[model samples]
Target: MLRIHFSSGDLARTRIAEEPDPLWETVLSLQQLREKSREPVLDGWRRRRCARGGRALRTLSPLMPSRGYFPDFLTPAEGSGGLESGIDAVLSTPRRQLCGELELLADHNPLPSEVRRLAEGETGALRRLGRALRDYHASVLEPGWRDIASRIEGDRRHRTETQCRLGTEEMLRSFAPLMGWQSPVLCADYPVERDVHLQGRGLLLVPSYFCRRTPVALLDETLWPVLVYPARPLCSDTPAAPSARLAPLLGHTRAAVLQALQTPRTTSELARCTGVSVSSASEHATVLRRAGLVASTRQRHHVRHTLTQLGDHLLTGVQLGRIPPPSASRHHGRA
Candidate 1:
């Protein structure tokens, strides 16, 4: 169990990361590759990654063992700047901290020869590691970045709605069944028992598309505390073709409304994009909302409409051509 102690100040400052942190995604994805368990969502990705495997696999394997510590420098706290920026951060890690973190890894498992050289601050090793990281991203993550970004954006929309409707405490409580939120403490299911004192630095809650089962947190307490948890699955196991299923049934206008809602948008904005009147767009949104495929919440003056989980699943199935026509058993429900 990992018990996170949150002072009142910490709670006030806690916020969700606005975008996916690429370095964290790389680290977690490496861990995913090391494990033999297969998830349906990763099937296509795994196949494509394995097919293109080469220096990325060979070079990164040593740094990420099947189990045990991976140097913290590999995933810097300043990763929001994107992949190249993150690689630069790794290359520029302070020598003492780099050696200390590497020593921690060495304590639990034998360091790969190249990694050992890296720990010694060898310039050549740093360049090679940077290359490996860049290659890994280009081969593994870049191809599907659009889908990944859409999914993350959808998740942020849902979370923002939750915060607007129920406040921060309830939003925190919604993270996962394994995570418990009590006054001043957020307890998480973890492999080992540990306590993290926030000390008013607060916590950054980052939602990840690849993270599975238990949430992840930084091992070193001195760094900015971050808790990475699994976001909702972006789509169903099978991909469906959208034009075939959705366009015919919903018509172009309604179909456009559903498609535009992968991210939140107000009716007027939806109207502008779909070239329909505001009233027409609102009617379409109303129908979608009544069908439980769209959710609309009034935020002060503007009402933002976002796709519900069912909406996303339906759209994904439609786009991929996997969803079947409505049946007695296929009732739409709230996300």
Candidate 2:
């Protein structure tokens, strides 16, 4: 069990990440790949990645064991831009901290001499490690990035909606079955029992598509506290059949608008994809937004639309042919 103690201020400041942290995804995904775990979702990804076979895997495998720690410098703090920026942060770590962390890792798991040198602040080795990280991302993560991003975005939207409707306490409570929440304490079902006191630094909740089993947090409590939990599974256990009832209600143009939001898109891009005028696309988006199926936000000059969790659920129901007709009233035979 991993217990995270919180204070009133901590509760007030706790928040969820708005977007996926690329570094966290990379490290966690690599861990998943190494373990060769039989997670259904990762089956295809693992097969494809193994087929490619490269030097990046060779370099990374030794440092990241199938289990145990992999050094915190690899992931950096949240808001460190994207993958490249995060890698930059890793490469730029001060020699003393790097040496200490690497020594600690070596105590538990053997490290390649080159990796040890890099940890000791060797400039050449740092560059090599940087290349390895980039190559790993290119070969492993870039291809399926769209699907990954969409799933993460959907998760964030769901959590945001939960927080708004049920309050922060309820939202925290909902992290259960994975982590039990009891007022000032949240307990995670970790392999090892541990305790983490927030000390009023608060906590950042990061939803990860690749994270499996127990939620993960940094071992060094002095750094910023974060809890990376598995995102809600996007794929159903059984494939969903198409919905017959949703199409006519939304009509063709509006339906097109809703479908185009599977990934975020600007009004113009939505119009282009649907073969409708921008004004028509905007109007359709407005209607969908009003119906709580889509959300539109202005990014500079362009308005981008993304499906809310309700929208995704509605679409899933439609795909499974499970959504009832809007006119189908529950009280029809009753009061």
Which of the numbered candidates is closest to the native, going by highest lDDT?
A: 1
As a whole number from 0 to 100, the lDDT of residue 168 in candidate 1 is 70
What lDDT, from 0 to 1, does candidate 1 have?
0.76
What RMSD does each model have against the real structure? 13.7, 16.1
- Per-residue lDDT, model 1, residue 113, is 86
User: Which stretches in model 1 have alpha-carbon errors above 4 Å?
Assistant: 37-52, 235-335
User: Per-residue alpha-carbon lDDT of model 1 for 1-335, expressed as tens digits?
Assistant: 67888887987788888988888888777778678546433455677765345688788887776665677888897787788888999999988987899888888777678888888889999999888888888777777677666677767777767877887776675553335565567766577888999999988888887777778888989999989887765455434335335878987558767876775778666664444567987999999999999999999998899999889988886353445556688686322
Q: How far is candidate 1 from the true structure (C-alpha RMSD, Å)?
A: 13.7
Per-candidate TM equals 0.67, 0.67
Model 1 scores worst on lDDT over the 10 consecutive residues at 235-244
- Model 2 lDDT at residue 255: 62
In order, candidate lDDTs are: 0.76, 0.75
Residue 324 in model 1: shift from native, Å?
29
In model 2, what lDDT does residue 93 have?
A: 86
